[model samples]
Target: MEAGNATSAAVLQARELVKRFGGREALRGIDFEAAAGELVAVIGPNGAGKTTLLSILAGISRPDGGEVHVPQGEVGWVPQQAALYRRLTVEENLMLFARLEKHEDPRASTEQMLELTGLTERRGEIVARLSGGNQQRINIAIGLLARPSVLLLDEPSVGLDPRQRARLWEFVSALASEGGTTVIFSTHDIQEAERYGGRLLVLADGEALFDGSADGLREAVRREAPEAADQDFETAFVAFLHHRGH
Candidate 1:
């Protein structure tokens, strides 16, 4: 489905989602909706509950309050850390995840993901020998095997070079545009959100501070300070956060 038709249905929804880690509240009631074919970037400063929110969305952790509407076993989650079989070949690692996911045709899925990640050429090499970027690619491939309608990722580009990062974003964009997989990712890179995120969800101090497009976020910041028209996105975003006392 094209992005035009993506808005027909909401693939995920968080109604007052809340989470508490011991005494600290990780999420203070987050509400958001995700369309079936859009890349929604969740951006925030450190310790702003971005990870906690993704955990809830991925069903890895239960929220203390509120509700998230996502079907069981229909979500692909990639944590910041790479989870791969370092001793196995790239193809073998993908196959391992495919079987774990119980994909109807694990081999076919592995082939598709191998080609998708551009790992087909190096499929026979051990994962430990691959560069950090290639390992990250394999980590992403493992998540893609779930054939999820909604894919959630937490800082998947931590160690990639510029080219690798570009390739990864292109791959994700294709999934959202052609495959209609709703992609929700968390990032501290503000410019990334402005560049690739079709929609943006800004969290601060365990609360949702803004939810809209990059232009919308800029316009929102501009409303508070007309002098910010010339500033870059990072500057404007910090100003916006400062305004909210985050």
Candidate 2:
């Protein structure tokens, strides 16, 4: 329960992380870490503890026993579900966070967020009035208001169509490649994870089955199942999961 050092070597990290909900253990002593400017994807099935891991790392929920190190500003988080005031305008939502975080100029910061998310034209539109994709952009903008070093997202592409999902991933890729923001996002879609994530962390039954780059993951799967080695990431990952007995 040490809040941990905000200036640690890794932007974010968890050691022997464990979390439980009554009788069931959601996370089982998983050790994880993210360095600055790295894009990591957490992949798992419905009950594989992906969201639980994200919430714990985001400091939204605590681990029953473990240590997590994060910098001063709260870790930016975009939950699977929207976390916004449906009645608030897009800019209004950003302004609320800007002021809450005590930004030097709330309006300026809010404007920057609007432009970043390509929501300037819809700044005055109520969140409930925007499409699901735009509402998600607001969720991400709010997360950026504090400029936290690490951003954690849960199923960020939940409601998007294939094209919209691709666009969102492109934006996220630029954020890491150009903006230098460390991002860790969870997704049930293995293909999406492999396509967008620079590194992959596979979790099954509350444990990390694999932690490495896409190519490394492919090699690992190939080593275990020669047939899958020659396949694409999606095929390899599915084999890897089966290898883990998920």
Candidate 3:
């Protein structure tokens, strides 16, 4: 759904997006938009096409139908898999990607990413030798090397411990709220969606079911299952899906 009526202000937009894998459809006529400096959470159960939607937005995949409009060469994508050169050190990996992205002054961008991602101390360490958290940090730092206007992360905090997850959120939240970068991330954690998402776009079976605030989602759940009016966010979401026969 459209985040707001101000479509001209949106930095990213997908209209009637459709994707299919073999006989099974992944996304169906999904319309989405995100304005500058907005933190949008893409949440749904497994097989909900959350990752598919992100891939399309990040320009990593093309939709079979519809269109996605974003500034060319200004989108950052962090997929579920680590896209780093394992044999290379953190600094080297950053430099390589910077050059690949044709970033002006690869050295300056590499150093900035190292410092911004708090990997300055570990810059010389091989990516294969770093912990999961540190590696994820490197992945994100590389995505940010070009100073993208829109950042798309698919399950970015998957393997991190609680402390690491907390730190990751702190950095991401500030990036959107203070740095004016549009951030869109997908996750199964409802609490994270409500806590970090300034806007939420929920998809089920490749269809967008809801798009708005956490409280707005609560109301949608309440309409679907009035008995769940007082239910917690996670429970309410489950009930909403169940009531819809999804």
Candidate 4:
């Protein structure tokens, strides 16, 4: 995608975003934007409000302050788990979600989705019987059943092994490449973030500590604090946390 084209295709924008949980503030004046076909990762410490930010973006929860503007009919959401019905078959689960979204030809679309996720052979199998990776694939398929323009995932690779995680990344990358879907996800794995994310958003104490490409982040660390260059993302992340006093 050209720079101008990407900039023009901003699918989701959050400005001065804030979320409060009683006495605590989860997101504090956060600002974010995702362009068409861009893959961005939101990285933060345990309580840095990554989930809260994703929830508001997914419309699963509301924010206490700020504005979230997403183009109508452009957003799709996949939560942490493949929350399919254990008793339902893979095909059945996809069709059900499609129908719930008022999609036409849910059956056919479900079949196509199965093929896309490499679950065609297992379409008739019960979700409960599928492996953890396969089940998560179904979860992602259901989220994409609507053919959303903007895809939001909350720790989509949380419980999977290395191979499963890699497979999921491949699927997500293909989706963005082919469909121009703006993808945003949160992950605790810095390696995953480095490998998969086109851009990075580092949050600490509900504040954006870094907003740029992964390379840019590296450069920032090298420029601001040279000692962090040899460390991996986890260590660098901790350095950021400590430096920020979070």
Candidate 5:
């Protein structure tokens, strides 16, 4: 697919983002964009800068170079960690975050989030008492408390059971499709990325190798490694990377 242009109507954009740690570069001039209601998956191996990229987009870390354009107070981020008040009750945690966001009605926002994340029944339970999956749900609920236009998830399915993962995807999918929210998720799971992303961004060694639909990725693999045409996606992807001298 074509790279995002300067004049594109994208809600979230990064222009030549660069990040470095000591002698190692975590990102090398990455350009990315996501429009409203789009599901974009970022797939890469460990230490390929997926986390660094997401952190930059979420404003958790400043990029060494480049600019990010996103509306102020319009972006929400759910990192791999459950950044919740473990001692607080589920409802209390949501209320606190909603108040921090300065929502016009923190009570209403908390109520909505409780229902949205299916945590109403567990609202009174202390956060530390919740299961891993439930804790993840609460974290995502907190992120959505203000109804952000852009949501960034970094390895969201980590430590989640299959059922929990399914539930999370269903909710996120609806948020992008029905709620008209832009969702960017990072993952190392090939199947998860291919299954969910309307578009995929493939990264390796801090470089963007490909960006497009799953079919486009397959076609790219077919062109780069003809023998991989009949292979599984993981095998074909490796072959494609080999051909690219990665």
Candidate 6:
């Protein structure tokens, strides 16, 4: 309850998280944590409940069982897509969301966000006109307008090019460095996780398979299954699944 020391206090924590859809269990039980200024990535294969876990943390959906504790002003969410109005300009969309949230300085924040997202030149362009990568950038900027201490990003690099993805991660790292924002993002791209995430959580069947540094995961794979050492993330992930089953 007492968030430990100011430096080490966890911005987000979930224990034994579970979710069900119809008769099937989407999440068995998941435990995750994000400390201040940490950039953690959630990696897993399809149907592994990565998105489901992120949704619960983002407050977009509730978990069937388990506890999620986040302090006020300590959370923000960037969904997979832009979620912007197709007819509205980028600036208009930001203004609309800010006003809906009843933020004190919607206009100023909107302006700042436009600058931050590199959308100043295209602020008046309809969201539908922007490229996919730019739209995603706007989505990230909108999420940050509230200046949350923790940020949850779900598959942010899905439609981005290599350059755009690199730029986005750079921005995220800068945010973490400057504001000490704890970021937890779900990624299918293992290379992206290796390059950007300070810590990695590999999930399988809704359970944490690995929770530690990327280097630690590599070492574990090497120790447990040497054959997977040369394989890429997807292959290694599959190997992990097979090894866990046997």
Root-mean-square deviation per candidate = 3.4, 4.1, 1.6, 3.0, 1.7, 3.5
Residue clash pairs of candidate 3: none
Clashes of each: 0, 1, 0, 0, 0, 0
lDDT of 4 at 224: 55
Tens-digit lDDT track of model 4 for 18-67: 99898998899988888988989888868888888998998889888999
Q: Model 6: residues >4 Å from true position, as ranges?
A: 1-7, 232-234
lDDT of 6 by residue, 42-144 (tens): 8877777889999999888999999999867657889987777889999999999888767899999899888888889999999998888888988888788
Model 5 CA lDDT for position 94: 98
Q: Which candidate has the highest lDDT of all?
A: 5
Candidate 3 TM-score, C-alpha based: 0.95
For 140-219, candidate 2 gives per-residue lDDT tens digits of: 88888878778898999998988778778887887788888998999989888888998888888888887778777767
Which has the better TM-score: candidate 1, or candidate 5?
A: 5
**Candidate 1 TM-score to native:** 0.94
lDDT of each: 0.87, 0.84, 0.88, 0.83, 0.90, 0.82
lDDT of 5 by residue, 1-246 (tens): 234223256899898999999999999999998888899999988988999999999999999999999879889999899999999999999999999999999999999999999999999999999999999999999888857899999999999999999999999999999999999999999889999988889888898888888888888889889998898998888888788777
Arranged by lDDT with the best first, the candidates are 5, 3, 1, 2, 4, 6
List residue ranges in candidate 4 displaced over 4 A. Answer: 1-6
Regions of model 3 farther than 4 Å from truth: 1-8
Runs in model 2 lying further than 4 Å from the true structure: 1-9, 229-232
Return whichever of 5 and 6 wins on TM-score: 5
Q: Clashing residue pairs in candidate 4, if any?
A: none
Model 5 is weakest, by summed lDDT over 10 consecutive residues, at: 1-10
TM-score of every model versus the real structure: 0.94, 0.92, 0.95, 0.94, 0.95, 0.92
Q: In model 4, what is the error at residue 154, expressed in angstroms?
A: 0.4
Which residue window of length 10 is worst by lDDT in model 6?
A: 1-10
Q: RMSD of model 4, in Å?
A: 3.0
Q: In model 5, which runs have C-alpha deviations exceeding 4 angstroms?
A: 1-8
- Candidate 6 accuracy as TM-score: 0.92
Worst 10 residues of 1 by lDDT: 1-10
